[model samples]
Target chain A: MKTVAGIDIGNSTTEVCIGAFDDRGKLNFLSSASTRTTGTKGTPDNVRGIRTALEAAVQKTGTPRVYPEILLLNEAAPVIGDTAMETITETIIMESSMIGHNPSTPAGVGQAVGEIIGIEHLSQAIQGRDYIVTVPERISYEAAAELLNAVQGMVSVTGAILQRDEAVLVYNRLRRKIPILDEVAKLSQIPEHKQAAVEVALPGQTIHMLSNPYGIATLLNLDAEETRQVMPIAKSLIGKRSAVVIKTPGGNVRENVLPAGEIYISGDSEQTVSIDAGAESIMAAVHEAGTVRDIAGQENSNVGHMLRRIKGGMKNVSGQAESSIRITDILAVDTLAPVQISGALAGETCMEKAVGVAAMVKTSQLPMREIADRLQAELGIEVRVAGVEAVMASMGAMTTPGTKLPLAILDMGGGSTDAALVTEEGRVAVTHQAGAGELVTMLIQTELGLHSRITAERIKRYPLAKVESLFHIRLESGEIRFFEEPLSPRFFGSVVLLEPEEMVRIEEDLTLEQIVDVRRGAKKKVFITNALRALEIVAPEHNLRRVPNVVLVGGSAEDFEIPEMLLEELANYRVLCGRGNIRRTEGPRNAVATGLVMSWWSE
Target chain B: MQTNKPAVHLYTVDETLPAIREICAGMEEEGVPWKILRMDGTARGLAYRAATDSVLESGIGLTAGEVALQMRKVAEDRPLFVFADPTAEQYRMIGANAARAVKKKRFVTVQAG
Candidate 1:
């Protein structure tokens, strides 16, 4: 009887499966475990994670620190995924000419155009001059309201900008109601003595005049050139509740098309495409190149620097020569980078077009024997480097209930998306593509303008909900969840990720549907797109319809929505697909590890 | 002056509540109309009874020692929020959130500390 433990080291995690052949020659998998991987896969550093995962699996089998008779390690996928974003367009505001925000409690309604004046300067104002009072944070609501009331008869104060959260307090006290914008942090930045248009939409509505370029031109009395310059500012103000546009004739908003430069794909033919051409054209060029042998970028350019950085990164990781590394696949996605408007008083962000690229890197080979020898020496056990990752995954996938010959398996991991197919005659075909979980996170981060990558990652991994009230939440599926106790007030009126234990608030101001739409759109862009590409390469004669059943096995396959999404997408091609349940027990996990052990006995 | 508009009613036994300004500002920020009046009674009992009598079906009974947010539809014994010895900030949140209940919007978190 041989007790064997199969270990699969991945970019993000390490998984272990312990199995033993009984005296009757029947195999039984005692337990499976997973832990965060210590370092890059296919390295000697993986031994630490391997030991942790093996110990966890051993604990599950009611044992304490028992090394298996033999350890089977998967030949980790050779592909390395690196993602970078290149800004194609930048929004440059010339001066403090715009203010756009959805302050939770902006007061009053309708639009007003006036000369921007400080509250203290109101005492010096003359009659017939329309003015907007800028109230700094130091001015109390009562004091500001008293001043506005005192000047109402003398000066035509059409609007008010408040630095503190007192727009409603001042608005409620006013005799003649004027549109008031509050929570303006940088009140001093609103260009002094300049003509500005301020608009506050009615509750539950967005500002129309300030959001439209032509409307802004009408309010500020701008000519054609000035109107054209404010288009990007107006674009950034869309869907905002309140906005202010100061007319500076010198206030130039330039939509500069940054020189992102071109990438060269060397394969069947040398193909060159500029990253500034956006994702569609870049992807077309990459696809046309047909099996990229190597990719290079122009010197001193954004794409060029990105390529060199990733190549340098790969060299550091695998200790391989930079010239030998090849970029096999590139998933280029068009995304909006939230570039902060330079001179805006409010911290407003305009969506600028950016190319987000995740490319797959691989060397001719990885030194798996070196890692195997180190692990064996440390554990004092026989450790063998197992079969190719995809083939072993296919063997483990067969342990799933009701699975038969001629099966295709898709392994979606953190770094790469891989697909493998095994025919009835045992002929295996495999394909590895770039862009998986990390790419999806990049898309979410760029699209949502979330400040932190951790926040973006949480949004990618969890479902979202809008905290509607103290006790209830409206989920992404429009299902209402009412809690028995009062939820935290900080989460109220914001979108939150529905984690298992607690509600984590998302800081972005978006509707639940919009956030879910972005999340799923990102998933579809990366996973669904890569799914089709992978299936085509591994399917019979590169035809998806010829493929039979598909079993999804990977860390990403266990994602709450990915498998269901793939099943729906693959169904269009009439392909049967579902998340794999290895040994009818482990759900879409430990496949590569379990496969390693099974393949060892089979051969 | 005609006070016929629908508004959240704030009732207090003593006329000298220092937290009234904070509470009023909180309600005002949400663009909700409100009225504060002197009522001689326990905070909970007055808020419970006043909730059904107010035009907006939302009422807050405030005192130096306690505060309560009551809704007309909910049972009088089980008010929405009843805090003992709430700070000024808590009173403000109670006022804003009670108005929010009337407006059918999400309530702000009432910090106990």
Candidate 2:
């Protein structure tokens, strides 16, 4: 009997399959283990993680970390850019005066035009001159209401911008109703003596005057040239219930598209596409240049810098030559990332269009022999670097009880999408494409304007809920879940990611529907697009209709929604596909490792 | 027990906690008219009665040791929040939350003083 271990060191994890085979070559699986990959895959740094996985399976009470007689490792596919996701466009706001805030409640319902005056300066205001008083945070609601009531008789108090959430409190005390905007966090930054227009829509409605450029022109009496300059401000405030646009000198909201530069894709012919042309045009150019030979970008441009930086990072970690690194595939998808509006009173953010790119890179080979040699020397065992990622994956996929030959295995991983087809005639075909879980995460992050990737990842992986009340939450499915114990107030009135342990609040200014739409849309864009493309590349004649069974295997394959989404889309082509169950035990995971051990029987 | 007058009911443990005045002022400042009533019970129990008895279906219950805010027909054990040894700021929030419930507005985040 020979005891062999199969180690699949992936971008995110290192998985090991330990099993024994008899003289007749029938394999019996003994145990398996998985650990977080310590470093970039296909490097000597992966040796520690390999040994850790082996130690987990071989550790038996005091028996000094035993090693398997034969160790086989799957060749890990590395995606360029050390990290796969990159945003091609960045938004820069210059000399802007835009405050786009969505405070849940603002008092009154009308448009008011006046010169803004701070509460401290209200006492010295001239009579008959219209003024919009700005209330700071120190003044209590009662104090502000009393002061506004007292001062209404003196100056023409047309409106008010408040630092605290006391708009309703102050509005109720006024004898005459006027529009009021509250919860202005950066009230001090607002020019005190500038001409401003405050508009508050009725309940269940959005502002009309401030959100429209002509409405602002009529309210603030701006000329045609000045009115055109504030177009971005009006466009940003369209759906807000209340908005305040102050005319600060030289304050202009200009949407500048930072030069993202052009990407040069070379196959049989060279194709050049501008990043600013957006994802669709860039993708068309990519498709035209089939089998990308070596991609380049305009020198010193954003795309160029990004490609070179990614190449540099990969070289540092993999010790591969800069000239040797080859960009095989690039997936570009249109995305929107939130950019802070300059001179915004409330740290308002606008979602700006960006191009999210993920590229697949192969360095001749990532020197898996170095990892194998190191593991062999340290463990004093025979370690052989064996099996391509897709081959190992398909061999492991066959362990599924009812699965048969002529099957296609889809390994949806973090950085790359890979597919392999094992024909009934014993022929094998494999292909790798860029964009996977990492790209999906980038889309979610950019579209929702989530500051952290972890938050975006949680939103991508789990279900969401809108905390309608303290005790109840309306799930994305429209079912209301009631908690017996009062939930923490932090989640109140916010969209939260329903993780296994707790409800994590998504702090961005977004509705539940918007978040869900972005998440589902991102998944569809990445997985559906890559799944079809990968299938076509590996299928006979590149015709998906000719393909038969497709088994999904990888970390991303375990996503709660992506499998159903991929299956639903694949139904059109009449291809039978679902998330793979490796050995009917591991749910859509450990495929490469399991297949490595199974490769022994094939030999 | 008439539900005609829509006022956020305030039920306090003792007649003079001094914090009750601030709570009443909070609701009044928010422009929602309120009526104060004295009751002796646990904050949760008093909040339940206050919410059930009021026309607006919103209530704030205060005991010497804790403060609780409730809305009628919600889970009795789970009032919006129950604070132990709540400070003056929290008492004001209790009033604001009850008024917000009546106004169909978002409840202000409650913080202990």
Measured over all alpha carbons after superposition, the RMSD of each candidate to the real structure, in angstroms, is 3.9, 4.0
Model 2 lDDT tens row, B4-84: 587888888786888786777568656687777787889999999988988888888888888898887777887887889
Write down the TM-score of every candidate.
Answer: 0.89, 0.87
In the range A333-452, model 2's lDDT, one tens digit per residue, is 887777776557777777777888887776767778888899889878888878777778898998876789999999898888889999999799988888899989988888887789
Error of 2 at A570 (Å): 2.2
User: Candidate 1: where is the Cα deviation over 4 Å?
Assistant: A22-25, A62-67, A123-126, A298-306, B1-13, B35-113
Count of steric clashes across candidates, in order:
1, 0
The model with the greatest DockQ is: 1
TM-score of 2: 0.87
Candidate 1 C-alpha lDDT tens digits along A209-285: 99899999899898898788789878888989998888876775667888887899998888999999999998899
Per-residue lDDT of candidate 1, residues B26-100 (tens digit): 788777888878888777887886687788888888877888888675566677788888776787788788778
The total of clashing pairs for model 2 equals 0
Which window of ten consecutive residues has the lowest lDDT sum in model 2 chain A? A81-90
